[model samples]
Target: MDDEQQDGRAVRVERDTMGEVEVPADRYWGAQTQRSLEHFDIGRDTFVWGRPVVRGLGLLKKAAAQANHDLDLLPDEIADAVVQAADEVARGELDDHFPLVVFQTGSGTQSNMNTNEVVANRAVEILGGELGSKDPVHPNDHVNRSQSSNDTFPTAVHVAVALELAERLQPAVDGLVLALEAKAEEFADVVKVGRTHLQDATPVTLGQEVGAWSGQLREAWGDVRHAGDRVLQLAIGGTAVGTGLNAPADFGPTVARHLADETGLAFRQADNLFVQLAAHDGLVAVSSSLRTLAGGLMKLANDVRWLASGPRTGIGELRIPENEPGSSIMPGKVNPTQSEAMTMVVTRVFGNDATVGFAGTQGNFQLNVFTPVMAHGVLESIRLLADACRSFTEHCVVGLEADTVRIAEHLEDDLMLVTALAPHIGYDKAAAIAKQAHRDGSTLREAALASGDVTDEDYDRWVDPAAMTRPG
Candidate 1:
């Protein structure tokens, strides 16, 4: 493991007949990587242990290997081998072959190694041989020569989030937007009571209220799209502290271009190396925007669930699709489970945003060791919230119907219509009429007609719930 190079200073490298057989347990990386293996291993999980990170790391390695092609530093044979290995990774060829182990912790190095081995073996197979030979092109020296985990990890995280979000979240938000817009159009003709302070105050079309909700969702859609766009900014070239040391001069830009072409992403190099290496602010910022949208959805879902509460006993203006019986003892009972699920999903998104914010704050100086967990947390939130949004729209919002019978029954009271009479009759007379109608077991229409304040034609025209609830 000890050797004297040209300068006669003892290098603690372990080399054997096979090659540099010994790697530093703490930091095995050549001077290229910062804090290397020791810096990456934070936590581990079984299900999602290494798949995404390994495949992505391998892809990055192959992408960087091509940098030498543009820079004219590597031969054609090696470049072709690297490209082949990367193609395999991008095609998901090695996903099932490797069983993720404890080595694939949150630190990401072991996962990176897993990727290297898979790609290298795969490339070797292409060259007509067995695995683990490290031949033709080495995973470390050739494929991953110019990069460090410091830059590669952040780059891969952004790429994965951006790709997956585009494939999943954006479309889900669009679906919710379409659903809300449909409701707005559907309810445009239905007039309803507009409540203020939980008491009937004025008239408004139901469509107008639904239109407001649609507008909020439209804004939320914009917010989510913008957050996804922010993911396009990558931190790829900023090797070990963003100094670009040990990296080929033009390798960063060249490789970034290659990757963009390969992945169909708009990845760009970090403008500020120091900030890119030291902060996780971009992820935090994007997640905060997602949280805002989730908050809006939670509020909207709660409102809809309350509005669709009951057909027989409550203000049943809306009816959601029934998936199952809501109560065991009660017959024909169904709960707004879709809305409830949406509420819970939004809550998780909020919690994930909080995690991202907190993790961003914890990145002290040169790097964020919590990136693996932080990225996973936000991605899971996005995936869950997006799925929940789609489910809520399909199962709940689309099928909801206004309860005209309940509307008519509630309209029969007409006690709320006494407020409209206040302008014609004095406020005191209106209150007295309302109180007498409440006590004397007569409708406000009968009390008013008896008191000679209004006629039948006026009662029908003026006291109708449809007319009373229309927006001014």
Candidate 2:
């Protein structure tokens, strides 16, 4: 019963120096990959390394095969097979084969070998050979030619992060900024009472307030873009310890050219692959920039939440579109759901950045043992922020409206309008007028006129809310 198991076809034996492993027969992965699966029985989360990293690794192998073929380092037939198989991986056709967790070996050697074995087996199949043959396409000797996990893993991180930022996050943030800019222009003339320390102080146009948020988002976008520049310098071709022992002198630049062509971004070899491979400061820089962007998003979301607080009892200066039922029990309640979602997403981004910062400093000597965790943190942050920006723009910012009537009503009867008179009249006189209005429950206009602090003509000219929003 145990000798020939059910169907006797589920798995086959694959051998490495450690021992033989029974790998699933249908899988594109081999011995080391099976060992990783058996050793790290961590979680069910399959996409821990994300799609971009997997795809970037595929691209790296594809480019390396071509470079090796061009330099006459590998045979043309085998190179063509490897290239075709790698392209399939890059297009996400082989995602199921990459099932390693994010909690693998610190150097990501297991993950890299997983990729190598998958690509090699698939290429072997394409060349009309049996799986795990190491025949026409060997995992390490052929598929992983002139590379090591130390260099390739970090290179894949940079490629994946940079491409995701330029393609997804940048466009989403651009949309948010444009939405806020349009709102600022639309609300330019709508004046409202301004507060400091949660108390009324002066008047300002609602456009100016919205414009401030737009400026913050633009600055955040700039920081992210600048950080991406650092991420474009890759650690590939460094091989074992940045010495490029097995790799040719031209391999790094040649692969960089291929990557630049494939991604449509200006990628280059790292100036010092030793430093890049040893330290994850490049990832930390990008994470820090994302943290700054998240901070800006938090401020903007809070402002929106406060501005659209209530229709009756709260500071209802703005109205957000009600996309869903606010509560299950409360029948007539509406909430700032989009702003709330954005704030929560920003909080997660902040946490992810902190994780990235901690992982970045975990480098010991020649290599960082924290690549998997660092990649997970930074990639998740980018993904969440991109989606959050799009959600905030579509659900909240685009459909927002100004409460012109409420704004005007608050601006007219406000005692803070006396601030205008403080310059024309003495401070003591203005204070007396304001105090009398407050005590007698009269409007500032009535108190000022009765007290004869300034003539009615001067009061009308100086206390204009629209004029107060600008310089004298």
The estimated TM-scores of all candidates read 0.81, 0.96
RMSD of 2: 2.2
Q: What is the C-alpha lDDT of each candidate?
A: 0.69, 0.88
Scored by lDDT, the top model is 2
Residue lDDT tens for model 2, 1-472: 0112336677767777887677877788989988988888887544434888898888988988888888789898999999998899888999989998888888889888988998999999999888877777899999889889999889988988998899889999999999999999999999899878878878988999999999998998899999989989999889988899899988888888898999899999999989988898989999999999999999999999898888788889999998888989999889998888888988888898889999898888778889888888889999999999999999999999999888888877789999999998889999999999999999999999998768889888889898888998
How far off is residue 77 in model 2, in Å? 1.1
Ten consecutive residues with minimal summed lDDT in candidate 1?
Answer: 26-35
Candidate 1, residues 273-300, lDDT tens digits: the string is: 6677688777887788888888878878
The RMSD (Cα, Å) of candidate 1 is: 7.1
Candidate 2, run of 10 with poorest lDDT? 1-10
Which structure among the candidates has the greatest TM-score?
Answer: 2
Q: What is the number of backbone collisions in each predicted candidate, taken in the order shown? A: 7, 0
